[model samples]
Target: MSHEFTVETGLVAFSVGGRAQFGWLDLVTGSFHSEADGQCINDAIVAVEFSSDVVH
Candidate 1:
């Protein structure tokens, strides 16, 4: 299993708070930093391109 990012795989985050956020995701190496303080995310998680959920 490959949890790393490829050429087409990248990360996109939403600003759920009032402040602006930033992240750097390297597609070739599958690396990322999601905060101004330089906090790294879990490297063991799988990167999924598509996700779906339905509610009835």
Candidate 2:
């Protein structure tokens, strides 16, 4: 199954998989970006955290 979200410029869709597998589409490029076996999202979160770890 698939789910869609309305973005400011266009629509984004995700391909739902069993359990933790999911894929997302890039609205601007019209490309299937990545699929996570439940890890990509968490990895992205970690990356963001690392980038923001420094105190300015």
Candidate 3:
């Protein structure tokens, strides 16, 4: 939404079955999940809030 960017992180989500979902995301791809992909919603939020990148 509004383009995939860190600043737009707050305004992005996937609406599946009419339910809000924060799927896997990447700095490039934004909100989307793939098999063995980026962090989940909880982990992602924590990373951003703490100003830390996931140690992949």
Candidate 4:
């Protein structure tokens, strides 16, 4: 299904997937779909990881 998190500052949302990739995101500027393959998608990142990194 879906999950939602509430922190002191703001809220966070997550969409779990059977596969490594999953997302159903909508933005005010535009909307798009995203995915992850459980692999290194970029080299610019270091010592930091995100469960879902969505780009719209």
Candidate 5:
């Protein structure tokens, strides 16, 4: 029960565990930005990676 989306350009937005998150991949700068709680950036990325529509 996973959800996937294709983003060609601009910003990609989503939510996880009632928390709002935003991500953007900058090809020019070779940098990525994700906004979420805590200082652990990996947590945000992981949350987006393993996200699903079905409740577990």
Candidate 6:
């Protein structure tokens, strides 16, 4: 016997409250920051890109 399964993906909130807002991102702009709490400000932009909605 064999079994198959599928998985779903979704966007998660890395920053809480107004920290969700992302400043204008441009090619020339090598830096970005959250006008709210500045959470993960020094962290890589791609690192905190996804928070993962799924538990697994």
Best by lDDT: 1
For model 5, how does the per-residue alpha-carbon lDDT over 1-56 read when each residue is reduced to its tens digit?
39544323333334444444555544455444563421223333322333436643
> Which ranges of candidate 5 are over 4 A from the true structure?
1-20, 35-56
Q: What is the lDDT of candidate 2?
A: 0.31
lDDT of 3 by residue, 1-56 (tens): 67654432322443433434434345664544422444454323322222225533
lDDT of 6 at 56: 54
Model 1 lDDT-worst window of ten:
43-52
Per-residue lDDT for 1-56 in model 2, tens only? Answer: 39666212211223343232234434564444333331233222111111234444
Q: At residue 26, what lDDT does model 4 achieve?
A: 33
Off by over 4 Å in 4: 1-21, 37-56
Clashing pairs in 6: none
At residue 25, give the lDDT of candidate 1.
57
Query: In model 1, which regions exceed 4 Å deviation?
Result: 1-21, 43-56
Query: Model 1 over residues 5-33: C-alpha lDDT tens digits?
Result: 44342334344343333445566666655
TM-score for each predicted model, relative to the true structure: 0.29, 0.25, 0.24, 0.18, 0.25, 0.24
Highest-TM-score candidate: 1
lDDT of each candidate versus the true structure: 0.45, 0.31, 0.38, 0.28, 0.40, 0.36
Candidate 2 ranges with C-alpha deviation above 4 Å = 1-21, 37-56
Reference-based lDDT, residue 26, model 6? 26
For residues 1-47, could you state the per-residue lDDT of candidate 6 as single tens digits?
A: 29542212222223433334443222244444443453434443341
Q: Quickly count the clashes in candidate 1.
A: 0
- Candidate 2 residue 54 C-alpha distance from true site, Å: 32
Q: Comparing 2 and 3 by lDDT, which wins? A: 3
For every candidate, C-alpha RMSD to the true structure in Å: 10.4, 12.9, 9.9, 13.9, 10.9, 12.2
